[model samples]
Target: MSWADKPNGNDMARRAGASRSDFDGDFAALRQRGRHLIAEIVRLSRQLTDLQQAIGSRRGAPGRGSVSGGEPR
Candidate 1:
């Protein structure tokens, strides 16, 4: 029939001997890992933003060209 119906029929055929409890446990574990990864990404993004701002401010400060204060060689 249609493409969508093919996959559904295939899934039904595959699940005939599969254990439901095992599938449920695997799904739950995957969901937990996904959430942990998202939190880590947010933390790293904030740290990167803070570091960029610090670098920009340092570069914009006055007397940045003066190393030891004798007109920079």
Candidate 2:
């Protein structure tokens, strides 16, 4: 019930630092996960661009495949 029963400053700081280290490690892991997600986003964007380009390259003339045989109605 006296001052001796209460933890000292050094003990409190050490405990705080121990918990702080766990938080720091968690932050580091989250940061790495964010980096991986960003990289995946960039890769997906590149894939989308490539798909758009491929589609554009494969398109035929406007009236080529029409059922009307490209003739005027």
lDDT tens digits, residues 1-73, model 1? 5223434424766678769885687568668878988999999988876766665556563432322333222
Q: List the residue pairs that clash in candidate 2.
A: none
* Count of clashes in candidate 2: 0
Error of 1 at 48 (Å): 0.6
Worst 10 residues of 1 by lDDT: 64-73
Please identify model 1 stretches exceeding 4 Å from their true place. 1-17, 61-73
* lDDT of all predictions: 0.62, 0.62
Query: Runs in model 2 with CA error above 4 Å?
Result: 1-18, 60-73
Q: Determine which window of 10 residues in candidate 2 has minimal summed lDDT.
A: 61-70
Question: Candidate 2: deviation at residue 57, Å?
Answer: 0.5
TM-scores across all candidates?
0.57, 0.57
